[model samples]
Target: MVAADSTMRMEPAWRVLGCRGCGSAIVECALVLAKIPYEREEADYATKEGRDRLVQLNPLAQVPTVILPDGTVMTESAALVLYIGGVAPELGLVPDVRDPLRREFLRWLMFLVAAVYPTFTYGDEPAKWTHDGEEELRRTTDEHRKSLWRLVEGAVRGPWFLGETPSALDLYVSVMTRWRPRREWFAQNCPRLYKIALAVDADPRLAGVWADNFPA
Candidate 1:
């Protein structure tokens, strides 16, 4: 469960556009957990208009590009999560700078974004990593990601990544479960993380977000 902060203040409306089931969806999840008001635009990666709009906003044509209340455009899903938490300190989605656990939170968060998340990027398109032996590259990256996730599994203290309370790390992991080797493989190889994914999946507050991003 997530800790609630009824008094946490939010900015006006923030606009976000991203493809559902992509990394951008994590940004939406963060906003939801932070209880910030937002509008969503679903980007269709397969279409030219969607790609053009994303590229126009971000230049990189990446999902999860957010336009803030003040009309500042922000990208990078992890940084966006931190930004939301900064404004709504009471949300507890991110650890405060003074909190001791803040270091641990950052450590895992970076590992997921910098280390684990890239595996998918390279694995999905092995040619990006190498011109030849694409299959081998994918295989190696997949195994590498599994081992990395095993380490993260051991870092789990309880139901959530940071124990009883859900944090940005948990939300990030929840979305990652749907990628790479898929959730079933994660469940078998990394039971602790799989449990955290289930906890996030069952969270009532996140139900609408999940449905919006990962609809059946």
Candidate 2:
């Protein structure tokens, strides 16, 4: 594991334990966009030691495990995104409770994490789930994931997921597109989401997080 910075040494800052190129990138980008001070510990789940460390903090050994300043532990990308938005509402990553888009935002956000994200969880390593029809399971999940993306694409507004303003939903599109079916597929099939991903990739606020997690 590698320490991204020594911010923890000087003050009580948020600490993120995650691996590069993983879902943790979503949380990292949220922190950066919120202008939150944080220290990152690269926890490569593929390695035994890294998995052990993460398991200690989170029994599930998930990436994007966050250590709050008050020593509270937080997991799940969507939850962390919401927490950051609450702490830094001025960032506008989450729509206000009164915003009309608030309902749509909440709707799709849960859809992504609950309905879509699980495809990768089970499909990425089929053998872990079962020994039978591993290849079939992967193919089915991939197709299912693509169908879910198409559903999201149909709902996308423009310039961002919710029409004009960017939000955590856009952040999710930006990161998840880089996985599985690949960006090439998205460009051809889900043009709106593809554009949002490219826009997020170019956002100055998240340049460092993108570079570290998805180096050119």
Candidate 3:
């Protein structure tokens, strides 16, 4: 709940390790949606050179690492989300940073990463990652991915994941949860999150990210 917990008092300098057409970039985009100030460092995930830089910060070579002004260099998209929200908790971008809420936040965020996130990007290639789904598994994985999206769509309670103000989760979920080539799936299925995604798109602050990734 980055949106619900961020504060108006803090204004920290930021640098996000992001990429094109990926989850990390989407979270960086979400920071913009919440009016969080940040600088962007683009990474080409498909290239080895990109992997090398990300290895220095995060061996996983993932995107959405938010470099804190204090040089925290936070990795893990969800960890970065929590870190940024801590700088300005009043903004409510994440849940409370040090209590029952913190645990709850991590629970959902991890579920998204472990269960939901993989179903999207890797849905097209489960065989490569899992080995169990060799040969012709993409079709099944894709179908499962869509089924997961339907679940995500149903989870949305309103204009945002938790409520009115979109949180860090919304950013990640919106981009990752999109229906992909099935563009209208969200609307044809979970009308609510689809509308939520549309609202996230309409946000002017997020223009930089979309322009850099899904550009016209």
Best by TM-score: 2
Give residue 154's error in model 3 in angstroms: 2.3
Candidate 1: residue 19 lDDT (0-100): 85
What is the lDDT, from 0 to 100, of the residue 146 in candidate 1? 89
lDDT values for all models: 0.84, 0.90, 0.67
Highest-scoring model, lDDT: 2
Worst 10 residues of 1 by lDDT: 1-10
- Tell me how far the alpha carbon of residue 208 in candidate 2 is from the true structure, in angstroms, after superposition: 0.9
Clashes of each: 0, 0, 22
For residue 133, model 1's alpha carbon misses the true position, in angstroms, by 2.7
Sorted by lDDT (best first), the order is: 2, 1, 3
Error of 3 at 131 (Å): 7.6
Q: Report the error of model 2 at residue 42, Å.
A: 0.8
- Candidate 3's displacement at residue 199, Å, is 0.6
| lDDT tens digits, residue span 82-128, model 3 | 76677667777787756444564566677777776666557654655
Poorly placed runs, candidate 1 (over 4 Å): 1-12, 128-131
Candidate 2: RMSD to truth: 2.5
